[model samples]
Every structure is written in structure tokens, then in C-alpha cells.
Target chain A: MFLVKIYVQLKKDILDAQGKATKKALESLGFEGVQDVRIGKEIRILLDGRDISEVSEKVRQMCDKLLINPVMEDYDFKIMEVEK
Target chain B: MKFGVVIFPGSSGEGDCFYVIKNIINKEVDYIWHKDLIKDIDTYDCIILPGGSSYGDYLRPGAIASKSPVMESIKEFAARGGLVLGICNGFQILLESGLLPGILLQNENIRFKCQYTQVRVENNKTPFTGQCSKGQVLKVAMAHGYGRYYAPEDVIKDLNKNGQIIFRYCDAQGEIEISANPNGSVENIAGISNKKGNVFGTMIHPERSSEEILNSSQGRVIFDSIIGYLKGVTVNGK
Candidate 1:
């Protein structure tokens, strides 16, 4: 079994509409001094397999294939092996 | 050119894309479902992703549809320099598919925005916007709740430098400067293209604005731009 943590974000060049809205909300909520904010997604993927490297590759593939938007998002992952 | 339009289960813009291409642009295109497997994925010259509430916006707009089977082929196709366009929820799909770059955050106002706004053309270099001159201001109808654009300063600057900033929300003057930047978007950007200028994405509904009865002459230019690009590429074989 393997555990993978995936983090997806909009590329630096891409805009983040959600974060700005949050910032606006925080400001409206009296959370002053909030200059700017950028929001992204973090996901944890767990898999059961022997070829952990293959799983890693698959995760990366997922990032580019469907997990992330190549246009507006970027994704990275960390892997850990589950052993008893 | 054999063009394919990706159709997910909830995509409502497929017909609009087809209608615009066939009637407005005078081009016939094929419909490609999200599950359809592409033999080569590289053979097609271009592809378009239509808009809709994929997965009924569950989890997120494109969280489910991005994982559809057609994405693999689209990725391969884009890697080989194939042209692709994602509009509205289609834009969200590109973000999920990693085709363009960026995340579609919820709108600043938290309400679904469906109105006609001005968009300024920032680039005329890509196959998507080659028909218009650089800095051309266009009136496009944007209908989305999460259409604000954001990116880091350096990246935004680089995008501006590389001419990847395709469309921007503009003011009454049709200038993509300050104060008129709706949605508080960074750089007033409304649409974008990849670094290679091949893949493109936008939140506005160009297909909706394509006809004169829609109250805008702007949509035709966008279609003309893409169609012109396709024709030019087809003729030049590049």
C-alpha cells in the first residue's frame, strides 16, 4: 500500500479568482490588512500497489491528464510507503 | 481540418460551438464525447471544449469532468502542438486537465454573473486570436460566477511580455487599463493562452454572442479569429 499527497495550484502566470473573492470576504468580515491572497487545492491520494514509482508516475500523469489544469493550474505530489 | 469538440455529460455549449462553427464560421466540426477514445489524439489539428455545469458543479466545476477518458487524448494531442480552446466551464476543464494554467475561483460577488462586458485583445500572435490586431477591444458576453483572473506579479508580467494575455476585461473606453477591470482581476485579464500560444481558455460565452440577434457583432470576430487561424494553418501546413 502507498500513500500519496497531491497538491494542485494555478500556475504563477494564471489568475486565481477564488482567492481574491476570499480576500474580499475577509475584508468585509473586518479582517483588515489583507493585501492579497491566492487559493489552490490540496488532495490526498492513497493507492495499494507494489510499484510505488509507477504510482508516482501515474499521479503525475493524473496531474497533467486530469488532476490539474495545464492552462491555469499546477500540481505536485509526495509519496509514502505503508509497511508494517 | 478535422476538428473535435469535447462533450461531457452536462456540457450545454456543445450545440453552440457546433452551430457557430457550421453556420457562423461556415465550418463543419465533429462532436467528441468525454469518454471517446482518440486513436491518435495527435492527428486532429484542433479541438474545442464546450461549457456546462459538469458534475453539476459538484466538488468543483471541472473536478469530475477533467478525469474523463477524452482528457488523455487531449493531453497527448496538446503535447504534440495541437490547438485547443476551452470556454466557460470548458475553461475550468482546461484548468483541471492542465491544458492552459490557473484555477477558476468562485466569483468575487458570489453570484453567477451573466452579462455583456468588454474584452480587450491582448495578443494577435496565437492561432486563436490571429484574426484581430493586437490590443483590439471587443464587447464579449461573460456568463459565469467565477470569472475573476489572478496570477503572480512576475508571471503576469511575463505573460504580458510573451503576448499570452489574450483577452482582458476593459472599460467603456475599450482600454484594458485600470478602474474598468471587472471582477477585480489581476491585469484585467479575461482570457488566456499557453506559453506556446496553442491552447487557449476564456470565461465569456462567445458562442452566445456570435449572432447579430444576440445584440453583439463581437462574437463573429472571435469565430473569425479562430476559423481564420485554422484556415491559415491548414493552408500553410503548420
Candidate 2:
């Protein structure tokens, strides 16, 4: 069996409203040189099946197929195998 | 099977959606009042949210309707892996309800465009769109004020990678196009679905073109896909 973790975020070319709010807050606190910051989250997938290799492949496919939006967001993943 | 369609006070597409899903599609469907809570959405197979000016788009489009009682049950159903589809205004509601992600913004050109637009299918393995093939393009009607879409870059890439970027706008020539990028939606997107692949939302009018009178024969397949999915479920017994 295998498990995966997926992380997604908006590209730098795009604006992040939440990040902007946070940046403004930090600036008010005297933190300088903070050009900008973007916000995103990671989805953890602990999948179980007989074929660990195939599940790993599906996890990557899921990232491309349903986990990330290629236009504005980029994604990365990690797969781990477990023994019964 | 009786499908539930929610009706907000200023909902514009109730009649249109009801006619298509009920009369044309020959399915038993009902309209649920927005004020009332859907006590048991698990009883039904599909739930639809029609386009509307819910809460008058006060703070933001769908910002208010996101908290409606009917939507609460819709959320429950979606959590249980039931199917739900939102259109235009409904798409906004989905975002606000957290059933889906991102927010709808004003049209980039700032024009109230009401016309036939082309869209490409980004996924095929869902309850609402089983019949649609990946990358298939279809022309549908679009009308809304704040329909632009926005989400985190990683979120966009994740949805695209996950095959969730349904209904991407295209040109009449079926080229990957973006002109009326309303609300600065990422990639000129018109619709999306959740990670579970059960919930879907779009800023288009499929019900308007279910008949030849609307000058397009593409919308029917959208509904057909849902029906197919429902039938499959009945056959499998959950």
C-alpha cells in the first residue's frame, strides 16, 4: 500500500488577496523587505491497496487530474509505500 | 426519482431548469424553497441549485446564499458523496458555501455579456458528467455579473491536474480562447468541481439550450450524464 501528499498554490504571476492582507498586517508591525507572500494548503492522502506502485501512479495522476489547477496553481507530490 | 432544485426569491433559472429536468428530461423533480432546510438530502440522488440573485448579491455574489438552510443539507449530501450541480449564480453559492473553492468576481471587461459561448470539458468521471469526454467542447449560454473565478495558484493547478477544470471558455472556432474574462477568472474558467468529484458548479446555461429553439444541442448531454450516473447507482445499490 502507498500514501501521498499533495500541495497546491497560485503562481506568482497572480495576486493573492489573503496574502495581501497578511502582508499589510506585517508591514504595520515594522517588518520590511517582505516583497510578498502567497498562501496555500497541503492535502494528505493515505491510500491503501494491493498494488503500491499503481497507487503511487494514481496519486500523481490525481494531482494532475483533480488535485491541482495548472493555469494558476502548481503542484508537487510525495509517495510512500507501507508493508502489511 | 424526484430531484430537488432550490429556488431563491430572485432566482432567474428556476423555471428553465425545472422545465428541462422535469418535462424535457422526463425526470421527477421538485423546487425547494431557499428559506426551508432540506432535512434529508440523502433521500434524493441529485440536488440542483439554479442561478439567482440570492441575497441580492449584497456583499458578493452568492455570499449570502452560501448560508441558506437548503444549502446546509446540500452540504451534508455532498459530504456523504451525493451529487450536486450549481450554475452561474449557483456556482457563486457553492464557493460561498465552501462546497467548492475560490470566489467569483466581476467580469474583467465589466460588460453584462449574454450570449452563446464555447466550453471544453476537463473531466469525464463524475456523477454529473459521465457522458462528457475529456477535452470535449460544447457551446452553452452564459449570463451573470460577478462570474470571474479566483483561487490559489496551487489550487488551480491542483484542480486542473485532478481533471476538475470543467467548462473552460473557448472561441466559436473551438479554439482555447478568452475574451470576456469576467471577474478575471483563472484561465477563463466557467465551471469547476470538488475533489470528491461529486459537486460541480458552472457559470453557464445548459437548461436554456436543451431544445433546438436555443440554437444549440449541446446542453442535453450535461443532464444526460447525471441521469446516467443515477442509473448506475441504482444498479449498484450504493
Best by TM-score: 1
User: lDDT (0-100) at residue B217 of candidate 1?
Assistant: 66
Model 1 misplacement above 4 A: A1-84, B40-43, B177-179, B233-238
- Tens digits of per-residue lDDT for model 2, A1-84: 666777777677666656777788899999999998777768887888667677767777766544554545777777777664
**B14-88 in candidate 1: lDDT tens per residue?**
998888887777776888878887886665667888888888877568879888889888888888888888999
| Tens-place lDDT digits, model 2, residues B30-148 | 88998887776667878888987887876457766776778777888899988888988889889877888887755655566688878877667777667877777787888876777
DockQ scores for all predicted structures: 0.25, 0.02
Q: Local error of candidate 1 at B109, Å? A: 1.5
Error of model 2, residue B121, in angstroms = 1.0
Chain B TM (all candidates):
0.91, 0.93
TM-score of chain A of each: 0.76, 0.76
**Predictions in order: lDDT:** 0.77, 0.78
